[model samples]
Target: MSTACPSNPRKRDRESSPAEQWRNLARTVPATLMHIGTSSSVKAIRSTKNAKSAMKAAKRSGDLSPAGKPDASGSSWPPEAVELLQQARDDVSIGLKALRDTRDAIVVEFFDAWKVLNQNR
Candidate 1:
């Protein structure tokens, strides 16, 4: 049985060079990781919301601390804590969108890079 060889070995070589592979990865890997991080952050936000809801349910059911204690259901958080959570959510949303945009731009760059490299052949 005979195996078929690539018709254009030089084109294949250029496409699969170590430098080209590295460049492709340099463009792709971080964007993929950032996407994963964004997914995790959104999941965490959902978990936080669920936990808050459960806490409220517990408090209403009288399973929480008595009304007079420091940790009582009636207790309130300082403005700082509330602001911090809000800021974190906002920051994550902004960062995730930015990362998505960056990924899109990188995709365009990849297309352009490949087009240029192919044209050079």
Candidate 2:
């Protein structure tokens, strides 16, 4: 005699193999890494804040050498480079917010996947 599959949609979903469940959950890894990258970039920017401030202060104080050239005695980012760093910091802050929102999304997705995979057991 031929056997029949379960008619319940939920039962069919729960029947997915463990490897399939793992592959489903693995999709969250890239999002997690993006979050980590944002956090690291923010932290790095914060750590350099003092140096950036010092450079700004020096520039404002006319520490430039004759002919309006930067003093060779110390190193600092060029104006364009500084602007780019500022842009990066702004972008990282926005990315961090987005990643924070996605954090909850990933967790809920993982829990749902786990529930589905374990429901049949």
Candidate 3:
């Protein structure tokens, strides 16, 4: 199999140089990687909607017993512990956002380098 670029959009009507063909192929790398990274980073974060629904269902089914927490649960958990858990959850959410931002920044860096390399051409 040929290791050359897969397709040349400019080849339909006119012949294109190898360098141009390779540059076109090179342009796709950063964009594809960024999309993959974004999807992966988004998948790392979990939404509380599902948990809220489950908690509601459990409360209706008499599976949860009240202790004193009315914030998100009816379970017999100490208020201090619940507060700590909520704080941890918030931290995790912020960390996940940072992860996504970092991934996007890496992609932006790559794109910037690409632009610099192709600038004088």
TM-score top scorer: 3
lDDT of each: 0.55, 0.57, 0.56
Q: What is the lDDT of residue 4 in candidate 1?
A: 35
In the range 1-121, model 2's lDDT, one tens digit per residue, is 2233677545333455667656866776556656655665566556456446644654654444344655454345356544544655565565565556556666765677668668768
Query: On residues 91-121, what C-alpha lDDT tens digit does candidate 1 reach at each position?
Result: 5566566556656666776676567557636
Give lDDT: candidate 3, residue 118: 70
Ranking by lDDT: 2, 3, 1
Pairs in steric clash, model 2: none
Q: Which 10 consecutive positions of candidate 1 have the poorest summed lDDT?
A: 65-74
